[model samples]
Target: MTQSVLDKAFRDVVIANRILANEGVVDAYGHVSVRHPLDPTRYLLSRSRAPELVERGDVIEFDLEGKPIGGDTRPPYLERFIHGAIYEARPEVQAVVHAHAEAVLPFTVSTTPLRPVVHMASFIGARIPVWDIRDSFGDTNLLVVNMAQGRDLARGLGAERVVLMRGHGFAAAARSLPEAIRMSVYLPLNARVLTEAMRLGEVKALSRGEIEAHASMKPDDPAMWRAWEYWAVRAGCGDLLTARP
Candidate 1:
C-alpha cells in the first residue's frame, strides 16, 4: 500500500479504538483491527493497551497467523487471534471488533437472544448467536488466545456480522472499519434496548424486510459518515477524520 493508504488505515484503527472506548463498548480490554489495504493476508491491530490510549504508533501489522510483522517486540492482545481467524475465514470482511461491553454480557449467558430492537442496530439481524468456549475447550480462561480457539469462534460467527462470546464479549465483522465500529457500538445499545423492552412485554424485533433494508447500508453512506464524524469528535479524534481514506 502507498504511504497515504497505510497512514489512513493506522489512523482509522486508532480512531476506532477511541470511539469504542468512549462509547463504552470497550474500556481497557477490547480491540479493533482492519485488513491491510494492499494485502488481504495481513491486518493491523494495536499492541496490548487500553483502547482509549491507543495511538497510530501503537498499531502493528500481523499476518493471518496473528504473528506481528517486523519482529516488533511489543506485547499483543491475547485475543488478536480473533481478528486473524475472522479475516482468514471471511475474505470480504475489512474490519473486526471484539469487546466486553457490560450491556451485552447478560444476553451471552441467558436464554434471551439479543436481537435488533432499534433501526440503527438492524445490522444485528433477527437473532445473535452465542459462542460458549466451554463447548469445545471445556473449562478454561475463555480467551481466544490460539488459532484453534479463534477458528472455533469464527465458525460460530459464520456468515453473521456479530457473535457473542458467552461469559466474555462479542466479535463483530464488517465490510469496513466504520461499519465494524458502528456495529460494535450499536450491539450493546441494542441489547440494552432489548432488555428494557422485555420487561414491558414480549420483545418485537425488526422484521425481515426492515433488517434487509437497514443492513444494506454501505460504508460510504452519508449517514454512516455522519455517525463516524460524531463519534470521532466525541472521542477527541475528530482531526483523524480528515486522514480517512
Candidate 2:
C-alpha cells in the first residue's frame, strides 16, 4: 500500500484501541486490531499494552500465523491468535475488538439471550452466539490462548458481528475499525438495557427484520463515522485525524 493509505489504516487501529477504552468497551485487558492495508495476510495490533495507552509506536505487524513480521517483536497479546484466526476465516472483517465487557457476561452465563433493544445497536447481528471454551478444551483456563481455540471460537461466531465468550467476554467484528468499535461499545449497552427491561418482564428486542435492515449498510457509513468522530474527540484522541504515514 502507499504510505498514506498504510498510515491511515494503522492510525485508525490505534485510535480504535483508545476509543474503545474511553467508551468503556475495553480497559486494561482488552485489545483491538485491523487488517493490513496492503497485505490481506497480515494485520496490525498493539504490543501487550492497555487499550487506553496504545500509541502509534506500540503498533506491530503480524502474519496469519500470529507471528510478528519484520522481526520487530514486543510481546503480543496472548490472544493474538483470535485476531489472526478470525481474519483467516472472515475475509470481509477488517477489524476486531476483544473485550471483557461486564454487562454482556450475565447473558452468556444465563438462559437470557442478549438481543438488541434499540435501532442504532440493532446492528447486533445473530442471536448472540455464546462460545463455551470447555466444549473443546474440556476443563482448562478459559482463554483463547492458541490458534486452535481461536478457530473454534471463530466457528461459533460464524457470520455474527459479535460473539459472547461464556465466563470470559465477547469479541466484536466489523468491516472497519469504527464499526467494530461501535459493536464493542454497544454490545454491553444492549445487554445492560435488556437486563433492566427484563425486570419489568418480557422485554421486546428489535425484530430480526429490524436488525436485517442495516445488514446492507457499509461498515464505514456516515452513522458509524459520526459516532466514531464523537467518541474520538471525547476520548482526546482527535490527533488521529491529522496523523500521517
State every prediction's TM-score relative to the real structure: 0.97, 0.96
lDDT by residue for model 2 over 1-245, one digit each (tens)? 39988888878887898898888877799899999989999999999999999999999999988999999858889999889989999999899889999988898899777889977788878578999999999997898899999999999899888889999999888888888888888889888888889999988789888888977888768777888888889889887864221
Please give the TM-score that candidate 1 achieves against the real structure. 0.97
Error of 2 at 80 (Å): 0.8
lDDT of residue 113 for candidate 2: 79
RMSD list, candidates in order: 1.1, 1.8
Task: Show the lowest summed lDDT stretch of 10 residues, model 2.
Answer: 236-245
> Mind giving the per-residue lDDT tens digits that candidate 1 earns over 1-245?
49878888899999999999999999899999999998999999999999999998999999999999999999999999999999999999999999999999999999878888799899876767999999999999999999999999999999998999999999999999889988888888888888898999987888988899887677878788888889999999999876333
lDDT of 2: 0.87
Angstrom error at residue 110, model 2: 0.9
Clashing pairs in 2: none
Task: Give each model's whole-structure lDDT.
Answer: 0.92, 0.87
